[model samples]
Target: MEIVQIVGFGLIAAVLILVVKEQKPLYAFGIAAFAGISLFLLVIGKIDAVIAVLENLSERAGVPSIYMATILKIIGIAYIAEFGAQIVRDTGQESIAVKIEFAGKVLILVMAVPIISVIVDAVMNLLPTGG
Candidate 1:
């Protein structure tokens, strides 16, 4: 459907860039960037549905809404960081991309700390310490 068309066009754009890059590197760079952005924008159309499903699943699992929200934020940070890193790499800035990825990992870990603490607390409660 729409996704098929978007993928098809994205592939065509990629191929075109590859072909065009040999003679016009500047144009190729712009085209590659534009293609990447367009694909991301197209995929964004489905993000809402995905988020809704996650929320429903989280509720059904009896998990706290705050945990679910944090998880979603972590996921958002991951995807944005990955996307940013990829774009930076595509522009030949591998060092910056690595830094971006590192930052993303750290942020994700930070966001996960509360959930980890909750798990640790639950396990501790179940341990049944000696009186």
Candidate 2:
């Protein structure tokens, strides 16, 4: 299975990183980052396939392209921020990792505002208004 290969690759990288870490901390970080990116690259095609399926389903459901795009962007931001945070954390920067996550949350919130407002409007329309 592909998962087995990924796990094996990850385990090998982990061992290599651990071995190098004692003598070369910087290289250890580099190894961790490179491994993380390589793993991401391996799954990128699957990510695209998922996006395509979601887009197809959204179209069938009559969802606006803008909403779908926003949702995808939010997902992307979360993944990228977490990835960056992990890389920074590998370098022993916990504070910076936290900041990166915080920034991602803020950006997600900003991107979500329009969708939230649309939902609120829909709900308000369903309520009875006093004449």
Candidate 3:
């Protein structure tokens, strides 16, 4: 029911944006932004459950909560960076959007370093010692 309303609202906004963009392009951008935020807000409610499941699975697997949290943060950064990049692109700033995406990728890599090290060490342990 709610999803239907959100989809309907998004469709209406998109059509209205197409109509108004020629005469009032700024207004169209505003409507698009509002719709984007509204849609994100609707999805945020479901994200909580997803997060809970991730947390539970990590605990069951004996994974450190910190690593799980880091992964979650990385996912969040990716989403926000993509959203920001898209908004920049919509404003005709392709270069700036590229920079934003690049920075996001770098940040994600930095955040994964600890997890990467842990995995590497575990794998190395699994190999028989040369000595």
Candidate 4:
């Protein structure tokens, strides 16, 4: 069912792109944009399902829920950032798209720093102090 929807969307997008090449470029762009968004929305549900499975597995393994949540957040950030960047690029705003990508990387780094600092502190604490 999922595969069928995906293939159908692709076919529609391709046909629209070809048709729009001559008649109405703007509408073609709109169709392409809608197609991309529709595909993303379709796959988003699968992503949620995958995350649920991951969370359940992590819980069974006694892994921290915070870790699982953080992982999912990172994935979400990447997906959104990439999607926005692509749209910007599609509209011929390459510079803006570059900035968007940069911002996304910076945001991800900011979110990751605390986890990194915690790990560093833990490792440091494990070391024996030399009097």
Could you say which candidate leads in TM-score? 2
What TM-score would each prediction reach against the true structure? 0.88, 0.97, 0.92, 0.85
Better of 2 and 3 by lDDT: 2
Ranked by TM-score, top first: 2, 3, 1, 4
Stretches > 4 Å off in candidate 2: none
lDDT of 2 by residue, 7-91 (tens): 9999999999999999998899889989999998898778988999999999999999999999999999999999999988888
Candidate 3 on 1-66: residue-level lDDT in tens? 887998899899999999999999999999888888888878878889999999999999998899
**Which stretch of 10 consecutive residues in model 1 shows the poorest summed lDDT?**
36-45
What would the per-residue lDDT of candidate 1 be over residues 23-129, giving only the tens digit for each residue? Answer: 99889889988988888887877888998999999999998899999998998999889988998898899999999999999999999999999999999999999
RMSD of each: 1.6, 0.8, 1.3, 1.9
Decide which is better by lDDT, 1 or 4: 1
- The per-residue C-alpha lDDT of model 4 at residue 85 equals 95
* Candidate 3, lDDT over the whole model: 0.92
Give residue 50's lDDT in candidate 1 (0 to 100).
92
The window of 10 residues in a row where model 4 has the poorest summed lDDT is: 67-76
Which ranges of candidate 3 are over 4 A from the true structure?
none
Clashes by residue pair, model 2: none
